[model samples]
Target: MGIISEFKEFAVKGNVVDLAVGVIIGGAFGTIVKSLVSDIIMPPIGYLAGGIDFSDLFYDPTGGDYASLDAAREAGAPAIAYGLFINNLISFLIVAWAVFLLVKGMNSLTKKAESEAPADAPVEPPKEILLLEEIRDVLKAKA
Candidate 1:
């Protein structure tokens, strides 16, 4: 086959399509998780931590005092943004937990499906067996 045909065949494959769908969904999921972390979860956390804004929290390696992260960046100063790291860490934990729950549920379903045996149905005997039984009946009648 020509390369173009081969490429077309590969592109239209089920696995490739599934992978593309997964990537798209994963990107959307990442966006949702980011929003959940930044908007929903972080607000409460920051509030509980005495009204600290975690995103603006940073450490300057040069020991330069900065009012905010943006200010530090504006001055072209290097900083270790630990608060952002913390937020990301929390986000990662949340995603991991979600995936774990999903996998656990799927595994539980799989196990249940595998453990449940199919109902036993009566199977017909072979034709030879039936013929033998018929012959036996005929012999008994003759006797």
Candidate 2:
């Protein structure tokens, strides 16, 4: 097959399509989690921690008079970006908790669905027995 045909076949595969959709949704979810951490969760946390901004929680080794972490970094001063780390940690916890709840709910729903479905429906007779009965009837008629 031609290169275009091979590419088309690969792109049209169900697994590849599903993977692409998953990647898109995951990216969107990450953005939402990041926003929740940076905007909604962090402000209250910062206020509780004596007005300490998590993103600006850093210590400069040189004790330079830079205004912000970016300024310090731009001045080539050594500083620990602990605030960013804390923010990321919070985001991880939130995402993990969300995933746990989602999986748990899905599992419960699956179990409930299975339990509600009828399980003891009567089985039909085998086709072979029906065919044998027909054959016996035909033979008796001939006799």
Candidate 3:
């Protein structure tokens, strides 16, 4: 078969389609998690930490006289943005927690569904067995 046909077959598969959908949803979820961490969650924490701006938390190794992180970057000074790393770490933890909860719920639902499903029918004995049983019953009656 041609490469194009092979590619088409692979792309049309259920697993590949499911994976593509999952990737798209995961990207969207990541964006939501980023926004949740930066906008909703960090503001309160920063406020409690005496109005500190987590995004601007950085260290200038060169000891430049820059006022802020932007100024340091503009002045071409090397800096480590530890606050941003903290924000990202918090976001990762939140996402992981949300995924764990979701998986746990899904597992419970799957188990419930499996438990509720009807069982298979029992198998019957073969014709020879049935015939032998009938003959045995008749002989016992005569005795």
Instruction: List, residue by residue over 1-143, the lDDT tens digit for candidate 3.
Output: 69999999999999999999989998899999999999999999999999998988999988877778898899888988898999999989988998999999999999999988876867789999999999999999999
lDDT of 1 at 51: 98
lDDT of 1: 0.91
For each candidate, what is the lDDT?
0.91, 0.91, 0.92
lDDT of 2 by residue, 1-143 (tens): 69999999999999999999978987899899999999999999899989988898788977888888998899898988999999999889988898899999999999999999889977777999989999999999999
> Model 1, range 1-143, lDDT digits (tens) per residue?
69999999999999999999988987888789989999999999899999998888899999998899999999989988999999899889988898899899999999999779565857889999999999999999999
State how far residue 92 of model 2 sits from its true place (Å): 1.0
Ranking by TM-score: 3, 1, 2
Clashing pairs in 2: none
Per-prediction TM-score: 0.76, 0.73, 0.78
Which predicted model would earn the best TM-score? 3
Where is model 2 poorest over a 10-residue stretch in terms of lDDT? 57-66
